[model samples]
Target: MIRSERNPAGDPSGPTHERVFRALRTRIMHGEIIPGQAMTIRGIALEFNVSMTPAREAVRRLTAEGALSMSKTGR
Candidate 1:
């Protein structure tokens, strides 16, 4: 199961996209995801037990934040 630290704002229930974002951000920050490791929207969705939309949004947010990058083929 995917586990994450509690929200610092004391809000137990947050948006799915935000939760996914925070979880992914935490993983990135902690070096859990090795540099250049392969990742996919479907994989993230399955791992986080979320739909493709939330996983894509998390990836988009992370990419915008420079936490991840996409190639010409969107890898």
Candidate 2:
């Protein structure tokens, strides 16, 4: 679920955290990011050019929806 590449529309553009998160959620719901990949707050924040708090919030929501795993470490 890396966002270093262009979007599905094939357009190179600006920050896409919401877009990235949406895409990842779709893949994750479809089991693409997977349990093994283990998404992290900092990593996603870095990937999407956002702050950790926002990334944390997004991941927290996903965990709540059972999309991603909740780590006690909460990294």
What TM-score would every model get versus the actual structure? 0.79, 0.62
TM-score of predicted structure 2: 0.62
**Residue pairs with clashing backbones, model 2:** none
Query: Where does candidate 2 stray beyond 4 Å?
Result: 1-20
Superposed on all Cα atoms, the candidates' RMSDs to the truth, in angstroms, are: 5.8, 6.4
The true-versus-predicted C-alpha distance at residue 25 of model 2, in Å, is 0.7
Candidate 2 lDDT over residue span 1-75, tens digit each:
453433424436433445556766888878767676766788887876666765776676677787777767764
Candidate 2 lDDT at 40 equals: 76
Give the Å error, residue 10, model 2: 18
